[model samples]
Target: METNTTSFFCLLLLISATVTAFLDIDELRNIKYGIDILNKPVLLSTQGIDKQLSETIDVTSKHGQIYRCIIPSQMEAEKQKEEEEKIAMEAGVPELLKPMESGPCLFKTRDWWSYEFCYGKHVRQFHMEDGRIVGNVIMLGYYESEFDWKNETNMEIKSRNKNRLNRYHSQQYINGSKCDLTGKARRTEVRFLCEEGTGDYIARLDEPETCTYVMTIHTTKICHHPYLKLPSQQKPVSITCNPAVTDQVYQDYLKE
Candidate 1:
């Protein structure tokens, strides 16, 4: 009789433990099947569960539990940024060039002429008199859609050690205002250079030929690369002096 009672108690405990495990699993399942505010489906993964609970409103489930399935605001922003970058790269855009694509224009002004360059867009030259616009805008060039910027490797610079050469990137803008003299449309060649510790800006602009323009831009984006360094950015070499020779020299100078 004692042995039968012990076995019956053990069976009851096993059934209780199994029922408790099932209840816990059912609660978790309810949490995972929450409704999203955006009406999109939510994943049931660990990270997804955390997002759902944090971003959605609680709703009653059949098990008398609250559940939600909304993505967090921070995670949504990150996903948007990543998608934009991916699209930009697929269009042959460089990472450093993205910031300039949709912001204020990069400009440099010289005597009576202010040159404005909108990256991957257009270039304009206008006259500003006494801080106010005075004359019609001269379109230097518009962005050339057919140009392949990724393969543009024509610009080269010789390193300080003249034997070494480095290739850089450039943009060619064309189909601007018609040139009176050349009988062709004006064009501009914008060159980008890597200067350490400087923000991106138009360093200089010149009309080298009739209706032909050259614009130089300096930026830090291209820094740190071996082949992208300018001739002036050579690494410094350290010098050392012998202590005994220095002492002897000091003594001779003192005697003199």
Candidate 2:
């Protein structure tokens, strides 16, 4: 009886350790905590089974707003499939089964695209949408002459913007949160939401940085164009624009 009790306790310890280890890894891969200011529709959690893709990421806006955005989950894919099937059924047509397409199935092909903003300097922004969640990453190349890359004060000011672009452009203000800034890392996390409308609502950066800024902009216009090729898949191209030219070109693309 004594031996059996000892073995049972050992088994329990092993099981506890295994579960703890699994949770640790899951927590590290996904952003289990924090709120996305962009008003993305998905709940924030690290419970997703897919390890290849992350469910949440930290983003800093051009004006230095930091926030977390949730990535689409495997559950979303299942929901999309079911919706498609339901549509087919309603149309009195048998749903055709198709092989799952290889590659990261985050957003619809029509909605996944990228573009470069070239004013005095160039910045690249990529938008990836999967259902209601949209992931955006903006890369601002380093300029050594402007300021020292390691300057803390400069970095802070450079990352932050005083004016709220969302309101200026007629977007409704939503909730937002900011994370603490620490160490030599010029990074912070903040998020907020703005009312989306029919206008082209592209997140813009006023100042360029050597570091990257990311955000998830929730809007229906994200996937409005079906024919526009994503910048990654297209040949090398550049768009040179002033403020007016930029607006015109972007609007024209949407019309197409």
Candidate 3:
């Protein structure tokens, strides 16, 4: 009987040690277990998940109570910074815009056509039918610095009213899919406006002439900035796309 009792106690100890090894003592301290009026167990934590930091506690559960504590100096500093950014965003203060090397493409769909703008990279126009791309994906334009914006269409004349500081508000996207009508590569000029409070959005797109397009974007990224700087000088923006999935819809469209 004594031998059986000792084996059972040893098993419990082994199980306890294994569980404790997997759990952070600090986290266990922060978590509070209790029963509600309905007899259901509940957990309460003094600190948020994101703000949690772990520190070793020499004492085990046998000790009266365990608690989680952190060196407040570093955590306090981070909290202050997060609060300041939240305040600035709420106040509509223009924060420094992020480098436009990579981000999710902004999409806008209109009657019978959909547009995708991969910022600082490329633009695409595609038609969809019955929830599938119906025709060839039209590359409106890709990023190119040396493309003569002046010879093609005078940007200076377009933004004549804006000051010199705002001259860079317009960008040229050149060398797109060949246009059957014009027998030239389609191109687009993306113009930025500061009307919207925040966010990058393609508000409007129009094809004024065959194979030539104009796109307008509304964003607060450049709201208060006197000078607009293009990040294209840093390096060529890398563009990536998933393989186009061809199903029965695509096959039918090809036949038509």
Best by TM-score: 1
TM-score of each: 0.48, 0.15, 0.43
Question: Candidate 1 vs candidate 3: which has greater lDDT?
Answer: 1
- TM-score, cand. 2: 0.15
Please say which candidate is ahead in TM-score: 1 or 2.
1
Instruction: Kindly list the per-residue Cα lDDT of model 1 for residues 140-249, writing each as its tens digit.
Output: 99988533444545352233224433334578899999999999999998877667688889989888899999888877765533344455322221111111123354
* Residue-level lDDT for 220 in candidate 3: 62
What lDDT is obtained when candidate 1 is compared to the true structure? 0.57
Per-residue lDDT of model 2, residues 76-188, tens digit only: 54466557545543432101111111212122122355543222123344665453335645333321122112243744533542333431111111121221332122221
Please report how far candidate 1 places residue 164 from its true position, in Å: 6.4
Error in Å for residue 89 of model 1: 12
Best by lDDT: 1
Which candidate order results from sorting by lDDT in descending order?
A: 1, 3, 2
Go through the candidates in order and give the clash count of each: 0, 12, 0
What candidate 1 gets wrong by more than 4 Å, as runs, is: 1-93, 145-167, 231-256
Stretches off by above 4 angstroms in model 2 are 1-193, 198-202, 205-207, 214-256
Preferred candidate (TM-score higher): 2 or 3: 3
Residue 109 in model 2: lDDT: 27
Model 2: how far residue 151 lies from native, Å: 29
lDDT of 3 by residue, 1-256 (tens): 1123344334335445322213444423343322111211112122222434322111122332222212111335447655755554454312333434465788898998999988778989999888788878999999774223334344554565255434435668999999999899999998776553467788899889998998987776655433332221121111111112235533555566
